[model samples]
Target: MPRTKGNHEARRRDVSEAVWRVLVAHGFGGLTMRAVAAELDATTGLLTHYFPAKRDLVAYALDLLERRSASRPRRAAGKGLSAVRAALLDILPLTDEATDSNRIWVSSWDAALANPELSDDYARKYAKSREKLRDLVAAAQQLGELPDGDPARIAAGAQSFVLGLVVQALFDPPAFPSHRQAELLDDYLATLNSPPSSGGDHEILS
Candidate 1:
């Protein structure tokens, strides 16, 4: 029997979630239809019903990671800067769940680089995320929670900094602990929240 579109999408979502579990447990290298089927306690034939090819499944899995990361709880973002901070911190590998998601992202990168569809999809997702960050920065600035400057530039810098810290924390948790990451983020935002220097200030060097 032919499945309805809604049912097909629901099944796809369920299969993609199983794929996500396999990706998180085994990374990209270990992902396969068999592994995903095993995760779902199903046969590869059922998975292939929705995703006929491995690339299709991989793309869906990577897309799932992006969606999951973006959908993190937002109950903490009640204010301007706090909202921005909460959004940015959600991307970091701070908790066990976040760490697993970051690992999946890292694992998917090499494959994304090789596949044009994946690459374009990743680029689009990142561009959208940066735009959201820029909007948050602009909001904070308007609310006097952040200093006035180029909000776009600030957003780009913040994104880069967070990505770098994610890598560092993933590589060496002992050296770059999660609390330290939070402290550094607070310090960075504090700098952004600082008042602009007066124009009449003079510097003398010897």
Candidate 2:
């Protein structure tokens, strides 16, 4: 008998979680249906039941990572600037789970450079994340909580700074602690609130 779609989806979630475990513990190259099946104590047939193709598995994993990555920050939206900062930190690869997700994303982005098929998805997600940050910064500005900088540019710059922090953590361990990150975020927010130069047109919101 043909299985129902919901059943497949349920299994897909299970399989996806298993894949996350493997990808976190090992890299993408180390991921396999067999490994995931064993991790879940299931069979390859069952794993295939959810993720029949490796690409399907990768796509699912990426979607999960993106959704989970964005959730916290979005929730923190109404709380205030501090909430927004907290959300941004949730996206970084500092902790074990975040590190795994970030590792997969970074590696996938590198692979996308040579793989035309994956480039669009990578670019789309990257742009969306940047836009989200921009929006959050704009919100802060609208509240008159931030200083006199251009929100668009300031948001982009802030995103760049956070990205640098994350990349630095990957290269140099023990330097991206949460408390330090919070301080860095506060510093960045303070910069955004700085005075704009004289006679500058700063009504832009892109």
Candidate 3:
């Protein structure tokens, strides 16, 4: 029997779904050709038809993760500090879906560190995320909602805080529930709104 274009497309979709399932269950560390094959109930030979090497498979999975992250619903648009808060909150693992995604993202760090190409890709992705936060921080400063300082520095700090929170939440779900996470984020943001001291040390915010 000859395979038609539709059949090939359907098979590709099945492969993608299988890859996602493997990622969610095992993270990148467990993302092997054998694991994906087991999830799909297919053979490694079939995966090889699509991805010739382990790196190829890993790269595809990473790209798939990025697409999923981008397509997920974002917080409603706003301005100033409110918008900054919304953007930061959107990154938290507040929902089950987000928790799973964050777990996969965290797991990818080891792989990214080992591979120079993947390391570069992750660096660019983080830079882009920081750039978005920086713009929002600059807007908030312009509106006088936040203290005067370097927007880029503030944004980097915010990103670091959120990522650290994410790891904590992932490790201790009982301790860092969604509401607690939100409250902590609010507390952090509130500090930014404080007026500068007589000492004029912007490092307080940084």
What is the C-alpha local distance difference test score of each model?
0.85, 0.70, 0.92
Which pairs clash in model 2?
147-193
Give per-candidate clash totals.
0, 1, 0
Q: What is the lDDT of residue 154 in candidate 2?
A: 66
* TM-scores, all models, native as reference: 0.79, 0.73, 0.91
The best candidate by TM-score is 3
Query: Over 4 Å off in model 3, which ranges?
Result: 198-206
Of 1 and 3, the candidate ranking higher by lDDT: 3
Model 1 alpha-carbon drift over 4 Å, by segment: 1-14, 41-46, 195-206
RMSD (CA, Å), candidate 1 to true, equals 4.2
Candidate rank order under TM-score? 3, 1, 2
Displacement of residue 174 (Cα, Å) in model 3 is: 1.0
Writing each residue's lDDT as its tens digit, candidate 1 over 59-164 gives: 6777788788778655477668998899878888888888888988888888889889878988997888899999999998899888889999999999988988
Task: Give me the overall lDDT of model 1.
Answer: 0.85
Per-residue lDDT tens digits of candidate 2, residues 6-32?
977876677667877887776666678
Error of 1 at 190 (Å): 1.8
